[model samples]
Structure formats: structure tokens, C-alpha cells
Target chain A: MHRTIVDADKQKLNLNLRELFNYRDLFLILAYRDLKVRYAQTFLGFFWAFLQPAATLLIFTVVFGRAIQVDTDGVPYPLFAITGMTAWTYFAFVLNQSGNSVIGAQEMVKKIYFPRLVIPLSKAVVGFVDFAIAFLILGVMMLFYCFSPSGNILYLPLFILLTIISALAVGIWLSALTIRYRDFQHVVPFLVQFGLYATPTAYPAETIINSLPDWAVAIYYLNPMAGVVEGFRWSVLGGAPPSDFAYISFVLIGILFMSGLYYFRKVERVMADIV
Target chain B: MSDIAVRVENLGKCYQIGHAKSGDFRESFDSWINKLRGINNGQTGESKEFWALKDIDFEIKKGEAVGIIGSNGAGKSTLLKILSRITEPTKGRFEINGRVSSLLEVGTGFHPELSGRENIYLNGTILGMKRREIKAKFDEIVAFSGVEKFIDIPVKHYSSGMKVRLAFAVAAHLEPEILIIDEVLAVGDAEFQKKSLGKMEEVTGKGRTVLFVSHNMGAVRDLCSKGVFLSKGTISQQGEMSKVLSDYVNSEAKINKEGGVVVNVSPLDKEGKWLKGTFLKVEVEWARNLFQEGINFDFSMRTVDRVKLFAFSSEKRPDFKDLHKRSKITLLIENIGYVNNELFIDVGFKYVNKDSYEALILNEQLITPSKEKIESFLRRDILVVPGFQYIIE
Candidate 1:
């Protein structure tokens, strides 16, 4: 028998990780629903995932690799950009979807009781499906170029873990803030667009790294996706291993993610009342 | 103490009504800037706090079905919500023993793109049922909904009724130790209402505690043995179902005067002391000069199910006279036969001379006390025994 006590106090950062784990089935179903629902009404279907980065690779290969070469060492530009694109796509999808998840589930949020964390976490899971498709494209492209992935490929899963945590860190923070301030909702879409250029998806991080003064490069790593993109490429394309700047990205992601969980739990108490 | 399924102790929920109206950035940012400048933004002055449920204290024993009756804005839903953990209370606390399931609104989490079969699993899991539990009850739910044919079709394609049936079927099969429901019986047709009511009774009969909130007085009386009546965020009465229900119905009958019409109904014993289940004194007042040819007051008694048991027009009295000035008409009926069905008296008026007049009718619901006193034999089909006498003033 479960005895539940509800009070006005203790409305702080109570994560209820056990409760969240108990609702793991809800999380998976929601992720499954998010994935199925996208294909439910669309004609192009999951191909959209593969086509988005594929098209971007084609555009960048022509624009950057040919028209305005930005020195990718020697690796084919398509192979170089695909890794960064896959990482950024995962980061952007999680940020955009999880940021809007609570508002999108407003009806359920107001009426049902579950660990609300599942909503954003499920968005992160759905983003993985897209990431896998984009990563598959990267694998096929590597085969076409006859380039074996760097032995650093052992660190690919670590980078993927960093990608998810970095995405969820921003995703969780933005979603909690978006509940209180709707203007954040408008900004989320713009983040995905602006983030495409701000990260190293279209060009190597070196292009900007080589130009910036020493201190500015340190600040550049603060944008978590930069490290995510560089880290992904180093593990897959075996370019210069990401600079020590990537460590700053790792540390900042740790701070942002811890604070994000704290802030999400704080807002969750008032969520039913406000949303 | 262990038998108490729910106990609310001084529980209250407060909502902030403010100029900002919504949780948007501009106002919060402005307020933040104003605070940085050490100036008050006047937001604090403009915002007011309203307690939806205040100092609400009650207890429901296990196996007791309790009905919470209230008028609109009466905080019934707030109580249920707090108990269900849908919203946190502003002050104090509440305790619920055993597992509790709340049906604040059915079909709350249904996704349009998901097939009915998928939604059944999705919504069930959302409402806190384990997947294996849902899988176990899957066939029973689909059968109960009678939508087995459309189970594989997306919910968006199902008609609204089919969707509700599916949602309600899922809700009905959830066998929690405590069930909290709010106004779900108001949906569906008469037959369906009967079925829903039966399902609720079955829940109570299984020795689970049920806290039910609804405006349907008859259904509440039929299902709950205990009752709580809420008015204006406070509990006005709570006790045996018979006492609480009668008090609720009687208090709802008030002298309403808007749109140039007022109606008041109160009962009296032959000795003239205020009483109930006896003769009724009905007063109908209308604005002067509107009824040029005098007004005809219509008095009616109908079953809560809306079967018009009797309707009598004032113009039928031989001694009645026409008046064009301020008019107050009173009708004293001798007896409203002792029938146990909950009844409603509707008071309406229009000009007696105009065959068809521009609508000037106000239907005030005058209520009859619960038929707790009715003998089984007296409770039959519609019984409209007219008053033994009528006196008009």
C-alpha cells in the first residue's frame, strides 16, 4: 500500500529519480509515440532525417569544399562535415523538441501525475533515432571515401553520451524557463538555426580556432555543441584530437546539466498550476 | 486510523490573479529591472490571491462512498485535485492512504495520431497503470467500450462518443484502493449515465473508498452514503448523505431577481412554521409596467430526470385579477404528495393575455428534499398529485 502525503512545503529540488525510473515505461512509450507520430502524417517519413543532413552535406561539399575551401587537413569535406552534422542534428533536435515538450503536453501535464522529466527525456530519446539515421549516413559516406574511422572510434560512445547530456542540459533549462516565460519558446527555433553556424557543422572548428586570439578560443568552447561537434569528428574522422578547449566544454556541460536538473525539479512543483 | 482512506487537514489552494495574466517574459523582465533599480513595480499591489479551497478538513473511511456536492466555483474540483496530487495546496497538507486514482477528466492524454489500441496502452500507462496491468485488462476494456472494431484506428478517426466510451472504459477498469472522480457522470446519455453510475457503485461495493464530486443530486444520492457540501471555498455541511443533500438542495433555492423577474420557494407546515416535505409557498415577482395585461405565473414540479409531474398556471384561479403595477404573486399549495424521487420546481412567468409574448421567462430551479422518507411502494412511475388547495395573493 502506498500512502501519499501532499504538502505545500518541500517544494524544492526533489528529483524523485526512483519515481522517474518507475515511469520508465511511460518515457519509452512517449519516445516511441514521438517517433511514430512524425511519420504518421508525412509522405516522406523517416527519410526526412537522412535527407536533411544529406542535403546539407551536398550543399556544404559544393560551397565549402569546392567554392570556398576552408582547409579540412586532407579528409574529404563530406566525410569531415557529416560527423559534425550528425552531432549537431542530435543536439538541435533535443533542444527544440524538449524545449517545447511541456507546453505540447499541457493537457496531460494539468491532469495526469507522472515524473514530468520523462517528457524532456523522451524528446532526447526521439532525437537519438534521428541521430542514428544521420550517423548511418556518415558511415556510408566514410565507405564511399574508402577512409577507415580513427582508432579514436573507441571514444565515439563517450562523445554520443556527451552529445545527449549537452543537449538535455540546454533542453531541460530552456523547457523549464519556457514554462514561465513563453518568449523562450520563440527563441528555441532560432537557436537551432543560429546553432548550425555557431557550431562546427559546416566547417572545421580550426577555421575559427586559427583566427581567434588565445583567450577567445577558450570562450568558444563554452558553446557545448562546438566540443560535441569537434569531439565527434575526432573520434570518427581521426583529425587533430579536439583541443584542450573541449575540456572547458565538458566542464561547462557538467555545470549546466546539474543546474538544469535542479531548475527542472523546482519548476515542476508549480507546473500543474501554471501550465 | 488506518481505515481512514483520506484525511484533509486545513488544506487550501491559492491562485494568484495578476495584471500580467500569463507567465510571459516582458512583465517578469520589467519587474526584474524595476527591482534592480530598487523601485517597486506595482505588480505586488495589482496582484491578488484567491483561495480556491480554504481550511477544507474532512475524512473518508475506507469502503465509504462520499459525494462532494457544490455549486459552480465551489472548490469541489480543487479538493479532488489536491487529493489526487494534480496540484499542490497553498497551505497545510493532506494524506491519502493506499493507492489512489483520480479521474479529473477522462481521455486527458490521448494522442490523435495513435490508434485506439495504442492509446489504450498509452493513456493507461499515463494514468499510472503498469503495462502488464493494462495488458491484462486490455480485452475487458475494449469489450466494455464496444469499439473493438475500431481499436486499430487512430483516435482522431473515432467519433467523440467512441472516444469517450474508450476513455471511460479504461477509467472504469482501474481498480485502485481509492478512486477520486469529478463530474464524469455528467457526460453520456441517460442509458450511458446509468451504466457509469452502476460502475461507480460497483467500485464502492468492492470496499474501496470513493470521493465523488458531481452536480447531479440524484446520482450522488444514489451512490454515496456520506456527503460533503461545499459553498464558496468552505464546507457548509458534511454528514450522512440524507442530511447533507437536503441542506444543499434547499440552500440552492434562493430569491433570484435579475432581468425584471424574481422567484422564491420555501415550504411550510400547516401551522405556518418553516418546514419541508409539506405545503410550499411560492412567490413570483416581476417589474411593473412590463406586463400590460397582467402576468401569469407558472408553477411546475418535475422529477430530477425532468419528467414534468405537474404544472399549474395562475390564470386558472377564478378570483385572479389583472394588474399593471408592481406585482407580487404568491401561491400556497396544500400538499406535495410524499414521493421519494428528487424533484425540481420551475417558476416561469409571461403576460396572460398575450397569446405569444416576447420571452420574459425566468426558470428558477426550486428543489425538493431527497426522497429518503419514501416507502418502496410509493416510489413508482411519475406521480403528480396536485395540491389539495391553492390560495393566491
Candidate 2:
């Protein structure tokens, strides 16, 4: 015999992982649905996934690598830039998509009851698919550059995991905020634009971090993406290991992830009313 | 086995009515901060509390098909929302002894780009069916929706009726121990509606618990065994389906014998001057005991055949508030939506009672404006009746 109890109020937030697990099919379906809608009827279709980061990599190579002459140590510029762009593009896309996922699903959110977290998290899964496509493009560029990945390639999965968590942390926060204050809706695109220039996407992280002072360097790692982008480069290009300040980025990501979850749970309780 | 399928205790939902209507982000944020600082109590006359549902307690036994009937704003939907977990109540709790499936609307998650076949699987999963379960019922749902020829096409191209049929088919196939449906049977052609109603009767015949909310009296009478009538957020009557239906119809629609205002709206003034297009003047004179605050007056204009045309409520009028016991209300409605026809006017006054509004009285009036006077004054070159359909060639 099965029984379900519903209370008017919950005194504290419960991180009911078991309940979320029961709705796993919903998460997968939403992700699949988004992917289907995104590429439907377009002539290029799924290839756009590879083209976005690939095209951006070309622009960065011409503008930053050749025109500005940002140093890539000894590696070819396209190979060097694509690795960073791969991680950054996935982060930005996930953050932007998941940030608006709740608003985009106003119809479903207002009508039915499911784990609201499933909506935002599905964007994370979709982002991973796009990342895989762009990653495939990067592998061909690596072969073209005649570069072999180092033993550090084994640690690529850990860096990828870190990128996903950081993106989801910031994405969930912005998504919940968008519902309450639509100002965040306009603020998110600006954040993504400003974040692109602020991170070490155009140049190597070592180039900027090496010049900063002790205190400034410590503060620089507070941006979680700084370590992730550097880790992506290190894993693919066999360059210098991520700086010791990488530990600060890891801690920052953890704090952001926890607080993002807490803030989302708080706002989610009142979403049906306002949304 | 437990005979009780659902048990609700003291269920209540309160909304901040005034401020929630529509406000700019900055203003709302300021209000939130002021509320926290205790500088703004939020109990100001402008921002008052409204309990959409209060003190609702009921028990539904297994195999009981209950019909929940109420007029607009009567808390019928709010109760369903709480039971379906779409929103939480402010207080109390509920328990269910079986898997619950609630369909607030058909095609809740249907995407326009997805084909009918894909939507079947997608909507089936959303309604809490496993993939294997959906696969098993796939052919049955397709057969029921009867769009088999275009099953592979995107739903966007299908006619609206076809979309509703497919959506209803997916929803009705969900097998749960408890099913809650809300006004989803209004769509589709009459024959299709009848078929879906037949399917619902089949569902309840198997001894499953069902809670149905519908305005269709015939459908409710045919499907539901017990009935619950809600008036202003509280259960006013609960008993056999026929008894509750009669009570709701007689009280809400058949007019009240208790005191209410008699309305007189005229196209021509007392001086016999034909009034022009801009105003439909209604003068309501009532000399009765008045409630201090939260007094709402509603004026409904319906066709002579009893088809409702339009309704105007004084609750939205901030200026027409705080009135004395003996007074006359002269309303100047700009661009009234009407044609040259006889109409009936029903005036109703509602007041807050036990956190929800209860109708104090309702007065109905039969009005026939002078067509000759209105036509002579109304310019044939210009049509002043707002929302009236006109084809000028």
C-alpha cells in the first residue's frame, strides 16, 4: 500500500534527492524537448552546435591571437584558443539557457506540479550535448595542429564536471531571480557579455595572473571560471598546471552551488503565485 | 484496505490581493523591504488580505465520484490547485492513500514543433506514466484521438480541435488510483466531448476515486455520484449530486429573496433627451445597511435570452468606495458593449465573511431601452456600442 502526505507548510527546506530521482524521466524528456525545438526545421540543424564555438574560436584567434598577439606559449593559437572557448562557451550557454528556463516554461510551471529544479537542470544537460559537439570540432583542430594531448588529458572529466557545476550554480540563481524581478531578465545578457571579457577567454590565464600582485591574484581566482578555463587549457595543451590559487576557485564554486540551491528553493515556493 | 481515498483538514489559502494584481518591479521591491522593516504593515486599505480558500475540510471515500461546482471566483479552482499540489495552502494538511494524477488542463507540456506521435509519449510521461506504460497505451491513445492520418505531423499544423482531442486522449488514458480533472471537457466537437465523457464514466465504473470540476451541469450529473458546492471559498452544500446542483442553481442563478438593489439604466434621460454613444448611465438607489469595507457591487448585462453579454464590478473602482447606508450610485460607463436589444440587468453586493466574500443580495431587473430614441440619437455613420460586431461594405 502506498500513501502520500501533503502539508500546507514545511518548516524547513528538505533536499529530497529521492523525490528528484523519481522524476528523472521528466528531466530527460525536457532536455530532449528543448534540443528538438532548438534545431527543428533549420537547414543546418545540429551542426549549429559545432558552428557557434567554432566560429567564436576563429574570431578569438584572429583578433586576440594574431591581431593582439596574445601569447599561447608554444602551442598553435587556434588549438590553444578553442580549448578555452569550448569550456567558456558551454559555461555561458548553460548559464544563459538555464537562467531563462523557468521563465520560458511559464505555461507548464503555472499549470502543473513537478520538481521545478528539473526545468533548469535540463538546460545543463542540453549544454553538455552542445559541449560535446564543440569538443568534437576541437579534436579535429588538435589533429590539424599536430598536437598530442598530454597525460593530463585523464583529468579532463574533472574539469568538465567543475565547469558544469559552476555554470549551474550561477544559472539557477539568475533563473530564480528572473521570476521575481524581471530586471534580472535584462541583466543576464549583460552579465554574459561582461563575463566573457572578464574571464581569460581571449588570452591565457597565466598571462594575466602572473602580472597581478599577491592580494589581487588571490581575489582573481574568486571568479570560478578562471580556474576552469585554465584547467581546460592545461588538460588539452599540456601547458603549465593550474595555479595553487585554483583551490580558491573550487571553494568559491562550492559556495555558489550551495547558495544557488538554497536561494532557488526559497523563491520556488512562491513561484506559482508571481509567475 | 483504507476506504478513505483523500482526507483534507482545515485547508486554507490566503493571497495578498491588492498588491499582487500588477505592479512595477521597483515598487514591489520597495514594498517588500518596507514590509520587512515593519514600516509598512501591508494591512493598508489598498493592500488587503483575501483568503481564496479557508477552513475547507472534506473526506472522499474510495470509488466516490465527486462533482465540485461553484460560480466564478468561488474558490473551486483554488481548492483543486491545492489538492493537486500546484500551490500550497496557508494552513492544514491532506493525505492520499494512492497514486494521484491531476489534469489541470489538457496538453500541459505539448510543444508546437513536436509531432502528434512524439507528443503522445511526451505528454504521457508528464502525466506520470512510465515509458513502458505509455508505450503500451500508445496505440489506444492514437485510436481514441482519431488523428491517425496526421499522427506524424507537427501539432502546430493541426486544427485546434485536433490538438484538444489528442491532448484529452493522453490525459484520459492515465491510470491512477485517484484522478482530478478541471474543466478540460469543454474543448473538441460535441460528439468528441460526448465520447470523452463516456470514457470518464468508464474510469469511475472501475471503483477509482474521481474529483471532477466542471460547469456543465448535464455532464456532472451524468458522471458524479456525490457533489460539493463551494460559495466564497467554503463548502456551502455537500450531499447527493442532484440536491447540491439544485441548491447551487437556485441560490446563485434563480435570484435571492433577501434584500438587494433594483437597477435602472436608461439610454434616454428622465428629461427625454436621447443620450449619445459615450455613456450608458445606470442609477442604483439602495437604502440598506452597508458593510463598512470591502463592499463589492457587480452589474451584469445579459441578453433577453439569458446569454451573458458583459459584467462590470465595482471592486476595481477605487473611487466608488466607503459608502453610507442610504445612497444612490450613478455609474457612467464609457463605450458600453451592447446592441439594439432588450437586456436584463442583475445587481449584486458582496461582503467579506469568514475571510471570503459572501453574496449579501442579488437583484434582477428586466430593462428594455427605447430603440427608436436610441437609433435617432445614435449616428448611423458611427457605431458607439463597444465590442459589437459590425460588417460595413
Candidate 3:
């Protein structure tokens, strides 16, 4: 018989990774429920998944390519924008969904006991489901542009993993904060809208990096999504592999993810009362 | 030591209410700014603190069904919540020997937009059941709920009774080592409640520990072998079910010593909400000057824990105007059911001058136990025919 301790100790800071793993089925189930519920009665149905990023791709190509004329580094602007949008859409989906997952599932959290981490982590599956559909649309765009992906496609999965991690890093922090500080609840959508531009989802990393001031570029590099989006270009579009500075984004993602975890665990202990 | 399923050591939970009730970032932010400006308006942080549970200690042996009973706000839910690990205690610790699942609600995570089949999977997994395990027990759960025909229909379409049944059915399949159930029994129809009770008994019969929190003292007495009485966040008494049950009833009687009325119903139906019984004793504390005119009592009975009225006495024409201060008014209510122990005892009369009289002072309702074991009274079944007995001072 295994034993479990319930206490008032405020110093317990471990992420309880084992519990999270044990609850992996619940995480995936929650994700499946979300995917099912999302398209249940909608006439648009699964098309909504493709519609969001495809629509955004069209808008970005027209606005950024036609008006401001952001550089695509010689690639077809539609192809460039769709690839970045694919990665960015999944990142944004995760941020928007996981950030709100805790507050959304407050009733479950207050009533049941499981690793609270499962709720937000389950949302990553929902992201990937929509991301898969968006990825298919990107494939269609690649065929339409007649640009076969380069051998770098092998690393596409790694970039996809990084994008999710990047979103989770910030999403985890936002979720805990949203419960305590509802200000974050309203701020999240605005943050997602702002983040769309802050990361190199629309313009190539090369185009913006050349124009921004040295310090501005350094701060920009801190966004882990930059590394993820750049990796996407490198893997899918066959660019000269991303710059060495790109590794900083991975390190930043690591630090943010680790600390976000600890902060979430710290908040989770008291979340029931607060929620 | 291994026989124990759960152990607690002086557990306590303190809540700072009022301020931050909304958890509004604006409020906290404004307060922080105000503090920076050396402002002391005190409107921002007017939080009052109270220990919802404190210095609580109890343990349940494996296979025991322990009932935790208390009046509302007496910390019953708080204690259960802590034990469920829904919230952490502020000052102590507890230990569990094995996996514990707390059914704080019947449909804890059910999504109305989803079908019954989907919710079973969602809710089962949320309660820590493996998907394969849920699938294995799938047909039994649906059959138990009697919602097999509507399993594919969205839960929102099912009647509330169907929903509760479906939810309870899923929870019943969770064979955790320790099952903590809140007052979910108070829902569903009388028959369904019995089914759920039997289900709980079956779970414990298999040697799993059960901690139940319910206001229906009768069900508690019947189902649980042990009882823990809580009052104002502390354990007042705990031991065998019968003794602790009597203590809880006594505590309710003791708290009504202040100027108020007490109602006594005999052979109380322990588990059934729509009760079959007789006799309601309305004893108003004779100290207060209640009225000057002749008082006519109107008795009514509602199902326990619900507001629906089953029997409302038309009016008692007996005039107790001249009855002395210490007199007890005894009015007979026919075919009366053991209710929530709530009665109108309409203590009013014809205003010696006006055409109509109106004064419905809703006082706190208390159940006064006559000195005897209710279980013994319940078995005789001879107490159903109760007549009024008035005592005059």
C-alpha cells in the first residue's frame, strides 16, 4: 500500500512529475473531449481549424507583403507567411487555451484531486489537433507554390516540439496568475494579439533583425518563439541553418519552462481556495 | 497500523474572507498603489479571517464507512474538502494509506454539451480511473444509471434526475481504496438515493474506506459504522455510529437554548425525503412576549434539505389568547410526514381590532429528540399515529 501525505507545508516545491505522468491518460482524455466538443454542433465543423490560420495567412500576406512589404528572404511570400503562421498559430492556440484552462476548469479543480498540471498540459493536445489540420493546410500551400520542402524537414518535429514548449512556458505562468490576478484573464487575448507581431511569424527573422537596434534585437531574441519559428524556416523551407544566437531562445525556453512549472506548483497548492 | 486507511493530526484551515473575494487584479493593484502613497482608507483590504476547520483529529480503519455530521457552516464541508485534498489545511497534516477519490459532487466534471458516453469517460478519468478500466465497466455503469437509450444524446438533453444518475453511476465504478463522498445523496429521487446508498455499502463491503458528509442523519446512521460529530470546526464526538449520531442530534438541541422554538418529530424517516410518519412538537421558548392576541398555529412540512411543501395545515382555530405565558400549543397535523423539521406554527391571530392578521416570523427550526433511541422507535412503526398533547402552565 502506497502512502500519500496531505499537509500544510508551504515549502513543498517539487513539480511531482511522476503524478503528472500517472495522470497522462486524463490529460489526453481531456484533450480529446475538447476536440470533440469544439466541433460537435458547428456547421463549419473541422473546417474552423483550417479556417483560422488559412484566413490569417491570407490577411498577413496582403497586409505585410503588399503594404509594408516585409522581406521574405527570396521565398514566395505566401509560402513564407504560411509556414510561420503554422508554427505561430499552434503557439498562439496553446497560449490562449492553456492560459485559460485553469480558470475554465475551476469547478473540476475544486472538486477532484489530480495533478493540477494535467489540466493545462491536456490543452497542449487540443493545440496539436488543430495544429495538425493547420499543418495539412500548409502542405497544400507548399504544393500550390510548387516548393517541395528541403531535407531540413527532418528537424520539423523538433521545431514543432519547441513551439509547444514555448507556449507552455508562458501559458503556465499566465494560468496561475489569471486565477489570482484576473487582470491577466483580459490581458491574455491582447497579449496574444501583440505576440503575433513580437515573434517573427509574419516577417522573416532576417528582415526584422537587420532593421532593429542591437538592444531591441537582443530582447527580441529572448522570445523562445523566435527560435521555434526560425527552426521551422530552417527545417521546412531549407534556409541556411538559423544563427548561433538562436540557441539563446532554446535556453530561454528552458528557464521559462522550469520556473513556470515551479510557480504553477506553488500556486496549485492554494488554487482550490482561491478559485 | 496498516489497518488504518486514513489518519489526521490536528488539522486546521483558515480562510481570509471579504477582501480578494473576487480575486480582482484591479483591487489588489489599487491597494498596492494606495499603500505606496501612505493611504489608510482601509476599504481595499477589509478581510476577516476565520478557521473553517481547526484542531480536527480522526481516523478510519480500512473498510469503515465514517459519517461526518454537523449543522451548516459548522465546518462539515470544510473538513471534507480538506480530507478530499480539494484544499489544503492551514495548520496540520493527514495521511492516507492508499489511492483516494473524492466525489465532492456527483457530476464533478460533466460537460452538458457532451453526450453521456463521453462524460463517463471524461468524468471517470478525472476521478483517476484508467480509460481501459472505464471501458471495461462501461456497460454496467450505463445500465445502472438506466440511461442506456440516451447514452449518445448530449447530457444537456437529459432530465436532471437522469444526469445525477449517470454521474453517480460513473462515480460508483471508481474502486478507490478510500472514497470520500459529499452530500450527493441528497439529490435524485428517493429510490435512486437508496440505490446510491446500496452502492456505497457495496464499495465498503469490498474493504474500501468511505468518508461521507451528509445532512440526512438517518442515512448516516444506517450506512456508516462510525460517526464523527463536528461543531464550529472541531470534532466534538466520534466513535460508534449510534452514539455519535445521538451526540450530533443533542448538539442541535443544545444550540437552540436561546429564545426560539423547537419542533420534535418522532420515528423520523432516516433516509427517505418523502417521509411517512406523525407528530410535530412546536415548543416556543415561553420567555419572549410573542403576541397579545389569540395565537393560532399553522403547521407545514417540507422534504428535508428541499423547499417543496408536502403538507401545510390549513389553520388551527384553537385560541390560546388567555393561555398563560408558559403554555405549550399542541396542534395536530394529519397524515404528517417527517419533514425537514420545518413548520410554520403560524403564531398569529385576529388582531382584536383589524379584519386580517399577518405575521410570518420564520424562526430557526430545530429538531428536539425525545429521550430514547430513534432506531428502536423506527422498528416498532407504531408511532405513525401521533395526536396532539398540549401542556398548560
Best by DockQ: 3
Report how far off residue A13 is in candidate 2 (Å): 0.6
TM-score of chain A of 1: 0.96
- What does candidate 2's lDDT look like per residue over B295-373, in tens digits? 7666666553345556666666555566434356766544343443344567666763443433433324434343343
- Writing each residue's lDDT as its tens digit, candidate 3 over B107-135 gives 88899899999999999998889989999
| Ranking according to DockQ, highest score first | 3, 1, 2
- lDDT, each prediction: 0.81, 0.79, 0.76
TM-score of each: 0.90, 0.79, 0.86
Candidate 1's C-alpha runs over 4 A off are A10-12, B19-22, B34-45, B255-261, B270-278, B286-300, B311-338, B347-366, B369-393
Error of 2 at B277 (Å): 47
The per-candidate count of clashes, in order, stands at 0, 0, 0
lDDT of prediction 1 = 0.81
Candidate of highest lDDT: 1
Q: Which pairs of residues have clashing backbones in candidate 2?
A: none
Q: lDDT score of model 3?
A: 0.76
> Residues A128-183, candidate 3, lDDT per residue (tens digit)?
88788878888888888898888899998898888888888988988888878878
Per-residue alpha-carbon lDDT of model 1 for A155-267, expressed as tens digits? 99999999999999999999998898788889999988988878888888887888999799888788998888898899998869888888889999999999999998878
Deviation (Å) of B197 in candidate 3: 1.8
| Range of the 10 consecutive residues with the lowest summed lDDT in candidate 3 chain A | A6-15
lDDT of 1 by residue, B1-393 (tens): 488889888988889887453576677777778889999747643788898989899998989999999888999988887787877898888888998888988887888999999999888888888999999999999998889999998999998888988999899989899898888877766676778888888888899899888877788888899999999999999999988987886686664544466667766755533323466677666666656656566667666666666677767655555644546767665444445455567666657666753333333354554344543323347565645455443
